[model samples]
Every structure is written in C-alpha cells, then in structure tokens.
Target: MTISTNSLMSLREYFSNQQILICFNGPISTNLIGEIGSALKEHIESNHAPELEVMDVFSVYIEMSQNIRNYATSHGFSDSESSATVVIAAAEAGHYAVCAGNLVEMGDGQALLERIHELAACDKAQLKLLYKQQLRQPHTQTPGQGAGLGLIEIARRSSQPMEASLDPLEPGRAFFSLRAII
Candidate 1:
C-alpha cells in the first residue's frame, strides 16, 4: 500500500475538522513519549493556555501513554497490538482533549472500561477521595500492575466526565479508546 495524494489530503482535512493539534500512531517507547510530551507542552505554552491547565494536560498525557506502554510490555503483545494512537485536539470553549487508543485483550479492555465508567460517575470530591485512597494503598506486587490512581487523577483533572469505548477487533482483542476533556 501506497496512499494516494487524495487520501492523504482527506486525512488532513479530517484532522483539521476535528481541530487536532497533534497525533501519533505506533509503538510508543519511553523516549518517544518524552519527546512527544515535550512537544505537547510547548504547544500548550505557545497557545497561551493557563499554567495549571497546561500542567494538567501534560500530566494526563504522560500517564495515559505510560499506561499503554506498560500494558503492552507486561502482556507480551506483538508490535501491532502494542501500538497506540494518541491525539490532542482543541475542543469548544477553549478546552483541550487528549485521546488515546490501542488494541487490548477483550477481557482486559472490558475491565478497564468498567473502571473508567465508575470513575466517570463520581463527582469531583468523590474522585479526590478515590485518588487519595488509591495513593495510600501499597503498590501491587506484580511489576506492571497499577493502583488505579492514574485513572482517578485523570478523572479529577478533567473538566468533563471521561469517556471510553471498546471496538471489537479480532476475536480475542478490541480497540480501547479513552477521551478526557480538560
């Protein structure tokens, strides 16, 4: 496959319509995450975003990307399965949205989606309590297991409720996507 010029143009048009400022799709490494994260910070600063909002967006992006990287590494996924698609877009009312997606085992995706839904239902105070609770728990023994604080933090920082979806892919895998508006 060769992508024709028309197809490329169409993709660009779609991104523009969505107000996407940055997008990356592939296997993410620590170095790549850092590089992209720096770019994101610069973009936010240049746009004159508030300092607190800029920090929130940067932190959320790092947390989400690291989660994807760790999940893929711990699960022994192939490169294609480990690859992630991350996007930062401008939302209405001067808000920004960070979205991420990757293929995951169907079961794992469902569990994560459920957790996200639970977090989404919570009010800000509830999320704060949850975050504090998670922070107090000892880290899981497993190398890649999380205490779920990252999800709670994301929810607390978001201006709107977080959203997540799973799209069935192969028999045992699905594409899990999450969007957080800040």
Candidate 2:
C-alpha cells in the first residue's frame, strides 16, 4: 500500500499508552537534527525503552531531518528567514516514523517520485548496491537542488520502503511529503 501523505494526526489518534518521544518542525539544519536527536534520546532513556530501540529511532530521525535540511536549502524554502518544518515521532509497537514536507519546484518532484518508486521495488541487496553506485557516480548540477540520494538512504534504513507524495500548490511549486518508518 502507498504511504499516507496526510498529516500524522489524521493517521491516528494519540494514545495515552504511548509516549511522544519527539516532535518538531521549522528550519531544518544539521544542528536542529542533532538537537532533536539528543532530546529524543533523552526521552527514550527516561521512558526506559531498550537501548537498541532508542538508537534505531534516533538514527532514523537524524537521517530524515537531514534530508529535509538538504531539500529546503536547495530549494530556498524559508519560513521566517531560513526555517523548514520537519517532524519526527516515535509511536507504539516499536515504530518510529519521520515525516518531512517542503516546497519543491515542479521539475524536482518527478525525479524524487521515480526514485521512491525504484527504491520501493528493490530488494535489500539491490538497494545496497544502488546506494554504493550512487555514491560513486559523478554528481549532476541541477538548477534548484542536489541529486537525491537521501530518499534512497531513508528507504534502505526503513523496515519498509520509504513513502512519498506530491501535492500541487501553484504553477511551478508543489508540496512534497516523505515518510520513513523504522
């Protein structure tokens, strides 16, 4: 099934039984991702979840947030001045999901969606090879953004393949929603 592109709140009702490990959005940067990761790590520790489980959530969140940072900077998306909104939340059933939405040029959406579809169809071994190959390839200079290996990385890290959707906002811009679950 395709991943839900809707807001997380619409995905399900919050549970009293489950703790919100972390949630934040606005201006993605390496520092912001690190800070959120640190906070979630603390939350997980206090909640007494297993160390491995906490580490998994922390790692995945960092990667997804970093992707948002890259995409926003490449697209020049600024809220106040230089702020992007990205959310990472830990849920029940040992699930941790990261969602990042941003404004992207229409041209960029097609390549990203194709990559998502390609990643979703690949097996683990193929994904590993593709990741390595991408790292080795010459970088192409796109007009508005860097080439997207981040989405592939997210798909590789996820227990399930990454999910993404595009919503048209205007003539030349669209809202891109990406989610990875670990």
Candidate 3:
C-alpha cells in the first residue's frame, strides 16, 4: 500500500503541532528499547532540558516500554499482538509526556486501568510513602505479577499524575495505554 504525500505531510504537521519529539510503533524488544532510549536522551539533552528532567523522562519511557514488552512476553503474544506504540512529547507546563500502549487481554487491561487510577489518586507524598512501603515488601517471582514497583517508580518520578486507558478491540482483548508526565 502506498502512503500518499499528503498523508505524510499531514502526519508530520500533526506531530509537530502535538510537540512530539520521538515516536515508535512496532514489536518491542530490549535492544530496540535501548536504541530508542539513547535517541530520547539525546533529544531531551538537545532541547537543553535539566539533567534531572532528562533522567526522569528517560526513566518513565523505559519503565513504560518495558512494561509493554514484559506483558507481551509473559502472555506469549504474537509479534503483531506484542507491537507497541510509544510517544514522547513536550507537555503542558514544560513537562515531558511519555506514553506507551499495547494489546492486552480484557481482564488484564481492566485490572491495570484500575491500578493506574488508584495510583493517580495519590498525592506526591502519598506516592513516595507507597513506594517506600512497596520496597519493604517481599519479592515474588510469579509471572505477570507486575506492576509492583516499576509503576510506582514511574508515578514517583512524574510531575503530574499518571493516566491509563483500556479500549475494546478484538474479542477477549483490549488496547491498554499508559501515560506519565515528567
């Protein structure tokens, strides 16, 4: 299928208008993530962002991307199913927004959405206290037991509350998207 020039131009304009710095959509892997992370770091640094801000944005990007990758791996999803869309952009109030999305089972997506909501409701201090408490807890090697610490860490690093959504898709599955602002 050929992409028309007009479509490409429109897409570029949309990205520019949205303040997107970097975007990716495909099967996610550790190496791919590392490469994209390097680019993200350079982009933020080039923008003259503070060291702390750059680190925080990069951390959130890593966490969100890894979460998508891990979920797809644990669920034994196909490459198509495992494909993820991640975007990093400048956000309101000079913040950086890191968003990642992938397919998930219906139940799993709902549960994750609920968890994100719970985290979103917490104040910064509350998030920090929760992070500390989670740190003190025992580690479990159970598969798909996620979101334990990484999600909390993202919330702690974010300047604004994190957000998530579940959109219905194929039968028994949905698209799960998460956003964090740093």
Best by TM-score: 3
Off by over 4 Å in 2: 1-20, 48-52, 80-83, 139-148
Q: How many backbone overlaps does candidate 2 show?
A: 3
For 1-182, candidate 1 gives per-residue lDDT tens digits of 89999999999999999999999999999999999999999999998989999999999999999999998999998888789999999998999999999888898899999999899899999999998888898888685675298889999999999999999998998999999999
Task: Give the TM-scores of the predictions, in the order they appear.
Answer: 0.96, 0.74, 0.97
Summarize candidate 2's per-residue lDDT along 31-57 as a digit string, tens digits: 767877788789778878888767776
Which regions of candidate 1 are displaced past 4 Å?
A: none
For every candidate in turn, the CA RMSD to the true structure comes to 1.2, 6.6, 1.0
Candidate 2 clashes between residue pairs 3 or more apart in a chain or in different chains: 26-85, 27-83, 27-84
| Residue ranges of candidate 3 with Cα displaced over 4 Å | none
From the highest TM-score down, the ranking of the candidates is: 3, 1, 2
Better of 1 and 3 by TM-score: 3
lDDT for model 3, on a 0 to 1 scale? 0.92
Candidate 3 lDDT over residue span 52-166, tens digit each: 9999999889988988888899999999999999999999999988999999999999988998899999998899899999999999887777888999999999887888989
Worst 10 residues of 2 by lDDT: 11-20
